[model samples]
Target: MKISVFAITATTIVAVFAVSGSSPSAFAQVANRPVLVVSSGVADISTLDPDRATNVGDVGVVSEIFNGLARFAPGSADPKEIQPDLAEKWQTSADKKTWIFYLRKGVQFHGGYGEMKAADVVYSMRRAADPKRSSFAADFAMIDKVEALDDYTVRFTLKYPDSTFLGLVSNYHGGSIVSGAAAEKLGNKFGQSPIGTGPFVFSQLVTQQYLTLVANDTYFRGAPKLASITYRMILSDSARELAVSTGEIDLIGGKREQRWVKRAEGRGMNVDIFNPAEFRTLFLNRNIKPLDNLKVRQAIATVINVDEIVRYAGKDVAEKGCSVVPNGYLGGNCGSGGYTYDVARAKKLLADAGFPSGITLRSVVSNASAQQPIMQIIQAQLAQAGIKLDMEVVDHATYQAKSRRDQSALVFYGAARFPNADNWLREFYDSAASIGAPGAMSNFAHCSVADSDIRAARVEPDPLRQLMLWKQAQQKIHDDVCAVPLFGLKQVWAHGDRVRFGYELKGALNLQPPITELTTVTRSAP
Candidate 1:
């Protein structure tokens, strides 16, 4: 397969919004306001509480209102730099078990809440570790306890050494620290009215309609340049594009198709695309026979045409993936032995596995419109290798539960983790962590071949050494043909002339349009 690299240089070329949807004079009327109108397709942003933020929409809202101890820089090309936020500095013991953090003084939470301190950090983190309070409780399992050493000092004792511990508690949505006083005062209502030490503070949430946030004037990072930001829920694809094209909204979460990219660019709008991409991996259940047969598995892997999948599934918005842990990031890419698209080899392997007559493989997938197309593409590709994919379409939740329960012979799962590869390799391939094993997040394939390497990688303190262990695990997965790696989801977003990203394009955690404090708006972009 030929590798393609595409990059667009950002220039201030501007155009007028001419698409027929909203009023033509809209831009002029809204030119003076320092409000950014973002069109997000997510319709279920019911909470602002970071711990309970299950969807990317809620996570995006939470990101604006909260700060983790450390965070990814605003316009960083890579997610590697661990910059301090609420925590001024942090250090770990030589054993790499105990972590101490010194908090920044005078950082205030929204709504005139008292100054943030070590106690607030401890309270927030402890609450996030509780299973009932956080959907990502498993992420915090490494923590034995969190203690406030003093008013500005906090300590965390870990059950074992974990190199990705900082990222898990620093950049992930679950890492957002809320004001303990605010949570107690507001109780369950805290999710709607969140208070944090971020650049922007929550102003109001209009349910499924939109959310509003105003600049935190006393923000430690300095007041956000944009006076306010308004996130609008525009679920319809046509409507969303029209809004951006007609200048009704400043920006919209773009569709993944290359054709959509072309349309947005043709209109002279700015299209922003970046990585570490979300991986769309094809997992074949080893617990099921035939698939349990190495030849059959290898045959399916050979026939898995990722290029065709990328063509059909938005080539511009995806990269041909090589590992279960996406192609790029701190994790090393050791995919020299990865499967390439070869139908002849697949046919031979299928015949050797006693599937010359063509075998039917049962599968289950989410019936969501975005997901169904990719599943159909997989079904079509498998047919080329004398394998009939009899996929049963179900709702999103059912698909996840059934896949985890080991009910499917084939599962095409698209996902992104917190820019780390260690936890990803463990939760997906380690026997003790996968679904069939006890307390599994998602081991859909029920794999254990890389269990030892994955375990070793997790506890390795040195970043390079830990990455070496992770590559070993990744290689094991590649050699076993444990799963077919598809393309990573290419994220694309388009904005009108009225707005330009305040900072350079950078990586984000699957939030379609990550509008950070650095995202800037012009008095008029054109």
Candidate 2:
């Protein structure tokens, strides 16, 4: 699936597009132009509605226009640092299953709906938990009830005490608060156009062109420094690199290839790279033939040259993934000591599985420029082990849709999950998250290799013990051969010197450039 949150595409880049809010006089055309122009490598945004967005690209925009009860520390990339947003402060009962939130007063919704109140917060959160209304409902399903106690206070009663609950409802994009009045007034069309109490207000979405937003002067935090922000979709990697190099765009998401990394540095641009990043893992359908056989799965794992694959995958941009949870992840980095690259071992396993001569299997992958090369490496690696992976390259979005239906024997998926370890483990290995299950958004592989460990980890009150449980769950996944934890991808975002992030770039929760109220764009020194 095209999750540039787990995304990478190859296409030609073009000039940035600018739209003036008002028709300018012939002499004033340049004067009314936007102060800042940015480029995003997304092919397109799914929806502006936070509840409907499944990909990071859409969530990026949603985050800009909404607030949650809490948020990742603004101006900081550390996912562990959480601070209040809509909720000025909150407290949990002694049991830790009940939460009381005191929202900030004087927050106003865009389009002047009125002051944001506890009723709006209650309505917004309940809508997100409603399975029929949100694909993200499963993330918040633990909440048994939500109550608005007053105009500025809300309460949540949970089924259990989950340490990740605050993170689940706030740091995750699904927790974004939308105006209840606006949502009802607009209905399904709200996704096309949305209203929120964020630093920016949605102005326009020109298909395949750009999504433009104007600053919210009355923002509770403060007015954004940039007068307007334009998200230009750049499909071509080479073009995107060139745009940043030539200063045609203030910022661009750089390609994962190390060569691109070096080239950008050569041009004197600043590139930010961080770890505990996306996981580019291969999921083998256990319900499918050959793959379902334990020996066959083992053989496939033994033959995969993960090191060589990373060699081709930009060693500096990525490294060997240790587990289902990437290194330094929330629960704690742990791996299921995978089989080494040994062709003989692979052959022996294949023979033991009764396929002495070898077996041929078909797999599907996205034909995106960056992905094809990696798949080709896997194809070649498998052939050496006498297993032929007949590769079918499909459009990225189609691959995501088809994979969820169990359409392929093998699937290559990538994602930058919420920082919590349980979020990743459960979505990939929980039966409840299996494809076609109610409220399923991920879990394309349809395998539940470690359901119990993950469940145990979710309820573990002790932080250290909880992390240990999460690690055990990842080990279970690796041992079961449900998927091969390929490598942890290091994300790169390059920008010209003129744009200031206003903070250190660590790791992002949603894998997008961490731009927020405190972010600023300063003119480069003359």
Candidate 3:
């Protein structure tokens, strides 16, 4: 949802009165004061560019300055229950092929970019669909057309009925709206200096240091409690923990390493560990040797003890993943309940697949501390099945590029957002979504079963019937061993007492904090 900065002035006045004695001068002093020092993790955020930001760090900064058609409140983590942002309310056709959104009026873009208009929504969606624009939201190719019905209305026509359309719009990567006039004037650099109707206006951004934002008094939503917010970049997790402990920072995003959780909790800090709507999995490249065989894939999947990995990773940190889709996802049936930790079956499968001394499979993974132990466990498990596994760890950016380029035989990865059954399943499996293709988002498994099932499910409209088709598709994905299901990601964040905001366990990291709901409490004199 869109958050206009216009309401800040009025909000500050009320907030000050509510907290301190209702003296005008005292209220002014509190209103002008900055409240929180937030650690936004490591990454350069100088460019307020959303399109180029593939990392979570950049998205966090961009989210504060920009907004989309719909948004989520911080305390409420449900991605499905999207509240009014730019659009007050919307409706879908009976067939689900058409969607009409009613826009909120009188919203002004930051930096006097322009007034909110239906044309702007149309322009943003069209630009995202355009190949030349290079939007991360290009996966929305499922949409056939977007039309501006009027100054305060926009309509979307899909190729077919898609129950997941709203979920797709909630994707923070490229779903945030941009002014058409600004895009025309700035061209490709429009993303670098985005102007939106959010609670915060872009003030200054420094690389690998901090992102500074000032409250937008012209925000349409109620003004933010904090006069200003600085997203400080802290590289080391320990340093981040220290910063929060010493009251140097206010909040720490995402899950921290297990060792730091206890230390942070000991300091009387609130450690929020929630079940996220994302899943992590191991992708088996069918184009690669050994993994090309279904038996080899099944052997690998059966050998790896997910329970053991969950134990090592910290039980509270993750849930065991049984299917490609996470447990709470729409159309997710947790698979046919077939996967089991049977080392004997793994060995037999490997032998039947022509592995005398096991197959040597190359596995690539990101350099996160949590991932290292998981990979080691997988390696040891494979060895028990007579499969010799070689592990290669690389930096996150390098790993992402390598996985996309299809250079790795087997790779460990996760989906950042859950966009219904269609986008999540079809984009990753449809034959049209092979690596290097336009619609491809996560097709690392390279399985024909995924391709066939996605094609059939797309045309099915009946909700119950479509779910059955998706179930079959998931079962086929499991049987093909396209990718070994791993576990659901547990979202954990730490916050100092000075800062207060709500968040959910879905969408991109930035989408969680409904900027309007963010409140910065003053420190009681200790």
TM-score of each: 0.82, 0.89, 0.87
Best-fitting candidate, measured by lDDT? 2
Question: What order do candidates take by lDDT, descending?
Answer: 2, 1, 3
Against the unseen true structure, what C-alpha lDDT does each candidate score? 0.74, 0.76, 0.69
lDDT of 2 by residue, 1-526 (tens): 4433101111101111224332111112222223456676777777888888876578777888888889887545465688899999999999999999999999988866779999998898899988877877878878899999999999999987887777766745579898999999999999986888987777667687677766676789876665566788778887777777776677777777788788889989898776546788888877679887989999998999898878776877887877777665677465457668899999999999999999998887887655778889889999998998888888666776778787878788877767678788877778788777875766666667788888887877788888788877777777878888888777778888878776777766666676676666664433
Residue-level lDDT tens digits of model 3 in 1-526: 7742222343454454345442233123235555556765554553566555556566667777777787654444467666767888999888988999899898887766668899988887877676667445546777999999889999999998876566556526667777888878888676566777777766555566665566766678766677767677676777777777777777776443455567678877878766443466888888889788888888888888887877766666677776776766777767566478899998888889888578887777777654666788888887888888777788666677788888888778765455456666765655566676665556887766766666777778777888888898888887777777787666567887766563433334452343442556466553
Candidate 2 lDDT at 97 equals: 93
List residue ranges in candidate 2 displaced over 4 A: 1-34, 333-335, 462-468, 522-526
Taking the tens digit of each residue's C-alpha lDDT, what string does model 1 give over 351-407? 888888878989988775457788888788889878898889986667766887888
C-alpha RMSD (angstroms) for model 1: 8.6
**Could you tell me how far off, in angstroms, the CA of residue 271 lies in candidate 1 after the best superposition?**
0.2
TM-score of 3: 0.87
Worst ten in a row by lDDT for model 2: 6-15
Task: Tell me model 3's lDDT, rounded to 2 decimals.
Answer: 0.69
Where does candidate 1 clash, by residue pair? Answer: 317-490, 497-525, 502-520
